[model samples]
Target: MKIGILTSGGDCPGLNAVIRGAVLKGIKAYGHTFVGFRDGWRGVVDGEVLELPREKVRGISKQGGTILGTSRTNPFDGPNGGAHNIKMTLVSLGIDALIAIGGEGTLAAAQRLSQEGLKIVGVPKTVDNDLAATDYTFGFDTAVQIATEAIDRLRTTGESHHRCMVAEVMGRHAGWIALHAGMAAGAHAILIPEQPVSAAQIATWVQEAQRRGRAPLVVVAEGFIEQGQEAAHSGRGLDTFGRPRLGGIGEKLAPEIEARTGIETRATVLGHIQRGGVPSAFDRVLATRLGMAAVDSVAHNRWGTMVTLKGTSIESIDFDTALGSLKTVPQERWDEASLLFG
Candidate 1:
């Protein structure tokens, strides 16, 4: 069987590991040939591809980002979009099955394509850890570790300067990264998309820190809109590829908190930093497991399903179930983190 693979949405650590694992396993175990589509769905639309062999995937397990590249192109968005033309491209390329690795949008696209008669298997990939089915996605742990380290370093600078350091992490609809990172770094306050905080509330947190003569550290998610300011006419709904962006909440909130609190505030947008560099030991192992499972699923002909981590084992789930709803940070988790806040 000729299998096709593509990485969609934003890049993250452990992506290359997934690719390497799949290619290595598929080639060794089943003798299945593999082709990699570049720039996500656009590559499929344009039929731009590269052949993947064991040599091509060597030493990519610890590498960050996708060796195949990625993009946020949504084929289902417009009239002449790439989604409509994918079938013809697949036929021309003689590709039998697809392994789509990405976050929500990528999984949703895979689900729709499967419904449209394309054989696909999904691997959940996100730094947010917001997918409902899986116990945790591969990249989320790496991102949190990176964010936590950044916060720890910034804490020293913040205290030395007596400044309110606001470090932004990535989370679109959930605050998993911010919640875990902030708590890990002992942040004075944590803001997340799940909890839209007001300027006044944040001001109080900063002011109290000032009163205690201690610099405040705040960790915020990029998608955390400040109350009514979220729905305004802004470009917060598009990705870097200019397809429905999902950032800028911390950029907007940082200035507001500074103005309201009268503290020397600064915003550090982690942006792509959270997604780059080497994968953690945990992520590499998890991604390798998922990749192996994905190859096994392809062998089993488990189309339209995704490989997910359930408890101690990797399990298979329907693509629709994985993409059905975003897994958000629960109130109890938020409250637990809140206990440390001033």
Candidate 2:
């Protein structure tokens, strides 16, 4: 069988590991040939491809990002889009199956395409760790580690200047990143989208921390909304998918925190830093295992399913099951972290 693979949505660490794992396992175990689609769905729509031989995947497990590249391109849009066109393209390339490595949006698209008769297997790839079907996803650990390190460094400066420090991590609809990083960094306050927090309450926490002769450290998810305040709009505008560009939450919150608490506050948006660099050992192992499992799914003809992590095991799940809802930070987990807050 000939398989095609593509990475979609936001770029992340361990993407290359998935590609390498799939190619190595598929070729050695099943003698299946592979082709990589460039720039996500746009590559399929435009028929852009690159050959994926076993030698091409060597030494990419520690590498970040995808060698085939990625984009937010929706395969159903544009002039040469739709199921028929994509199917025709695949037929022309002699590709029998597709291995899509991406987040919710990518998996949802693959689900729709599968319904339209395209054989596709999904591999969940979100740094937010928000997918409901999986206990955790690759890239989430690396992102958390990065954010925790940034907060650790920021704490020193905050203590020296006796100023409040606000660090922002990525989490669109879930608070996993902020919650984990905040707890790991011993933040005085942690804010997330799931739980809207008032500025006054945050100020109280900051003041309490100051009263204890400690510099306040607040960790916030980018999707976190302040009570009674409108969401901060990014100057960068929208992407091809029509979703508003997310950012500026930390920058917007910093001044508000300073104003309310009467303390100097600075915001550091860990923007793309969390997604770059070498994959953590945990992420590499998980991504590689999922990648190999994806090929096994393909061999078994398990189309329209995604590989997921359930505890210490790798499993396959339906796309709808995975994309049905986001795996948000539970209230209990938040409450546990809250116990440490000022």
Candidate 3:
């Protein structure tokens, strides 16, 4: 059997690990030949490929980013896209199956392709940890670790200047990154898309921290909004998935916090730093497990299925169930973390 693999959407840590795991497992266990589709679905549409031997993927499990590359290009767009074109392309390339490693948008596309008779399996790859049917995605741990480290560094400078620091982490539809990082970094406040807060409330948290003679550190998700306002954005156009280019919330919140709390404030957007680094021990294990499970599912002809982390085990489920709903940070979790605020 032959397998084609691609990494889609935004790049993150543990992506190379997934490629390594799938390629190694498929070759050793099933004797499957592997080809890599460059730059996500565009490679599939344009018939771009690279031969992936065991030597090609060796020692990449510790590396960040992807060996096959990635992009946000929607597979349903353009004349050469859609399931039929992709299926024909796969046939001509002599590829028997595919393993798509990505987040929600990529999985949704894979779901449509599977319904249209494509032999494909998915490995969940969101740093946001929003995908359902999985307790946590591969890159989330690495992202949280990175964010927490950045926040910890910001804290030292904040205390030296007695300034309020707003650290923005990535979380579009969910608060997993912000919530975990903030709690871990001991931030005075944690803002998220799931829980909107007014500038006044954030100011109050800052003031309380100031009164305690501690520098205030506020961790905000890029998608966090003011209580009555829309989600934060700088008018940048939507991505291929039609989601807004979310960012600058920390910059927006810094002035708001400084003005209200009478403290000098600074904004630090962690941005892609969280995505570009060596995978954490946890992410390496999780991504490897999911990737190997994906090929196992493909071997069994589990079309339309996605390999996911169900508690401690890696399992496969249909995309519909896997993409059913986002795993947003629940109110109870926010409530529990709220006790530490300020």
TM-score of each candidate? 0.91, 0.98, 0.98
Decide which is better by lDDT, 1 or 2.
Answer: 2
| Highest lDDT scorer | 2
lDDT winner between candidates 1 and 3: 3
- The parts of candidate 1 lying over 4 Å away from their true place are 76-85, 227-255, 258-260
lDDT of 1 by residue, 1-342 (tens): 999999998898999999999999999999999999999987887789999978999999999999999988886655435544788789889999999999888988898888888889999999889899999999989999999999999889989988889898887678899999999998878988888777788888888777888889889887776766744224655545455565555566667777888777787888889989999999999999999899999999999999999997999999867777889998999989988885
- Please provide, for model 3 over 1-342, each residue's C-alpha lDDT reduced to its tens digit, 9 standing for 90 to 100: 999999999998999889988989999999999999999999999889999999999999999899888998888788989988888899999999999988888898999999998999998888999987898888999999999998999999999999999999998889999999999999999999889887888899899999999999999999887898965655678875677788888888888888887899999999999999899999999888888888899889999999888778888889988886999999999999989998
Q: Give the per-residue lDDT of model 2 (tens digit) for 242-285.
A: 77788888898899888988899999999999999999999999
Error of 3 at 231 (Å): 3.2
The residue ranges of model 3 lying beyond 4 angstroms of the native Cα positions read none
Candidate 2 at 49: error in angstroms? 0.9
Clashing pairs in 3: none
Q: Using alpha carbons, what is the TM-score of model 2?
A: 0.98
